[model samples]
Target: MRTILQRVQHASVTVEGEISGKINHGILALVGFEPEDTNEDFEWITKKIIQLRIFNDENHVMNLDIQQTEGEILVVSQFTLHAATKKGNRPSYIKASKPDLANEQYEKFLQILENNFKAVQKGIFGADMKVELLNDGPVTIFIDSKNKE
Candidate 1:
C-alpha cells in the first residue's frame, strides 16, 4: 500500500454535480493498494495517519495530532498512485491491484480509519470524481508500506 497525505483546510468530492463527501480542517489521503498489501499494511498506515503530529498546538507548533484538533478525514481511492513510470513516456499501472482486490482493500482501509477518527469522508471508488481542497500549510507526506527506513 502507498499513501499521499495532505493537510487541508477544506476538501470535498463531487460526482455528477452532487457532493458525496466533504470535510474541513483535516487531512486528505490518496491511497493505493498493491497485490501484496494485507491487513497489517492497513493497520500500520491508519495508525500513523491518526497519530501524525502535523496540526498546530497551543503554541502554534506542529505538535498536535488530528484527534487533538478534532479534525475530519477524506480518503480517496487512487490506484494511479501505484503507476510505474520508469520506462518510456507512458506510465504503467501494473503494480496497482486489480479493481476487485483494490476496492476491497480500499474499503477496509476506510473502515479502519473511521474507527479512530471523529468524521471520515470518502470518494466513490472507480468513479470519475472532482476533488477540491484548500491545502493547509501545504504539508504533504508520502508513505509506502514496503519502504521502511
Candidate 2:
C-alpha cells in the first residue's frame, strides 16, 4: 500500500462536472495498492495517517494530528502512485494492483478510515476525477507500507 498525504485548507473532487466529495482543514490522500497488499498494511497505514503530527499547535509547531485539529479527510484512488519509470519514456503500472483488486482494497481502506476516524470523504473508485485543493503549508508526505520509510 502507498499513499501521498497533502495537508490542505480545503479539498474537493469532481466527477463529470459533479462534486463527489469535499473536505476542509485536513489531508488529501492519494492512495494506491499492490496485489500483495494486505489488511495488515491497511491497518498500519490508517494508524500512521491519522496519528501523524502534521498539523500545527498553539505554539506554531507541527505537533497536532488531524483529529486534534478537528479536520476531515478526502481520499482518492490513485493507481498511478505505483508507476514504474525505470524502463522507457512511458511509465508502467505493472507494480499497481489490477482494478478489480485495487477497487476492493480501496473500499476496504475507506471502511477502515470511516470506522477509525471522523468526517471522511471519498472519490469514486474508478471514475475520472478532478481534484482541487488549497495546500496548507504545501506539506506533502509519502508513505509506503512496504518500505516503512
Candidate 3:
C-alpha cells in the first residue's frame, strides 16, 4: 500500500459533474493498493494516519492529530501511486492491484478509517474524479507500507 497525505483547509471530489465527497480542514488521503497488500497493511496505515501529529497546537507547535483539531478526511483511490516509470516516458501500473481486488481493498481501507476516525469521506472507486483542495501549511506526507516509512 502507498499513500500520500495532504493537510488541507478544504477538499472535494466531483464525479460526473456532481460533488461526491467534500471536507473542510482535514487530510486529503490519496491511497493506492498493490497486488500483495493485506489487511494488516491497511490497519497499519490507518493507525498511522489517524495518529500523525501534523496539525499545530495552541503554542504553535505541530503537535495535534486530526481528531484533536476536529479535522475530517477525504480519501481518493489512485492506482497511479504505484506506477513504475523507470523504463521510459510511459509509466506502467504493473505493481498496482487489479481493479476488482483493489476495489475490495479500497473498501476495507475506508471501513477501517470510518471506524477509527471522525468524519471520513471517499471518492468513488474506478471513477473519473475531479479533486480540488486548498492545501493547509502545504504540508504533505508520503507513506509506503512496504518501506514502513
TM-score against native, each model: 0.97, 0.98, 0.98
Write candidate 3's Cα lDDT for 1-149 as tens digits: 99999999999999999999999998999999998899899999999899999999999889999989999999999999999999999999999999999999999999888989969999999999999999988899999999985
lDDT, candidate 2, at 58: 92
Rank order (by lDDT, best first): 2, 3, 1
Cα lDDT tens digits for candidate 2, 110-140: 9998999979999998999999999999899
Model 1's TM-score against the true structure: 0.97
Candidate 1, 21-139: lDDT as tens digits: 99999999999999999989999999989999999988889999998899999999999999999999998999999999999999998888877775899999999999999999879
Q: What range of 10 consecutive residues in model 1 has the weakest lDDT sum?
A: 110-119
Better lDDT candidate (1, 3): 3
The Cα local distance difference test for each model comes to 0.92, 0.96, 0.95
The candidate with the higher lDDT, 1 or 2, is 2
Question: What order do candidates take by TM-score, descending?
Answer: 2, 3, 1
**TM-score of model number 3:** 0.98
After the best TM-score superposition of candidate 3, give how far the Cα of residue 15 lies from its true spot, in angstroms: 0.4
Which regions in candidate 3 have their CA more than 4 angstroms from the true location?
none
